[model samples]
Target: MKINYSPSKNAFYEEEHKERYLLSGSWPGDLIEVSRDDFIEYGGNPPEGKTRAPGPDNKPAWLTIPLDFVEQAKAENKRHTDEANNYINEQQWPSKLMLGRLSDDEKLLFNKWLDYLDALKEIDVSGAPDILWPTPPAEPAS
Candidate 1:
């Protein structure tokens, strides 16, 4: 008996006995044991199973804020801004607060609050549509 093999599927078949078997050893390349007449008459085409397409080359775009969460986020941002502003008003800059008299922790806290205020100034409150997600780069030609 002669052995026939399909490297793509990692399988083998015995020619005269007409038996099929999964490959147990390393492939020996594309070897056909049956005569062309026998192969054409009996063997039909080999199965080509489904193959997965390659994944996108670039990373997926970031998720946008859902419509339901937008209002909540705006409210939280407003609350934080108000608290920071209140702290600033009570401290009164140019007084001991800004005169380098405060402790290191106090100075750090003040700087952080100032940074928060600066960031709040940049926030867009116009409730713009959420179509600003980054797009993956186009796939290269095959």
Candidate 2:
């Protein structure tokens, strides 16, 4: 029937739901009438990555929430970190073999992997979404 938006909370409130769930919470915005279909399309008041905005005719509108590059970068950083961690986890045992057990070439590859992991740590992902992922070392032979 009618939807109101709270800029402070970045939430949408249906006149009915507001009274039921958020009796004391502030739901600020001139109530705008929208069709039931429109309400469902907005996913119960601006689903993640979206926010409500005033429509051209003073109806209601939804727009994409601005991309958070810093958060994106952090997520990218974590992804790369996790990948490297898994690689090292799976491949490090061969490096721990008894001394002289590994051929010279095998040791070199393992060391290369570790070096890549170290380089990854030094990367500044605060600039995330623009990260240059380090090249993984060639998987070493066991």
Best lDDT among the predictions, by candidate number: 2
RMSD in angstroms, all models?
Answer: 21.1, 11.1
Pick by TM-score: which candidate is best?
2
TM-score of each candidate structure, all chains considered together: 0.32, 0.42
Worst 10 residues of 1 by lDDT: 51-60
Displacement of the residue 122 alpha carbon in candidate 2, Å: 1.1
lDDT of 2 by residue, 2-94 (tens): 765444444457777766555565546455555667566754545555556555655456765557865776677678778877875675545
- Residue 23 lDDT, candidate 2, scale 0-100: 59
* Residue 123 accuracy (lDDT) in model 2: 76
- Tell me the lDDT of model 1 at 139: 24
For model 2, name the residue pairs that clash: 73-128
User: Candidate 2, TM-score vs. the true structure?
Assistant: 0.42
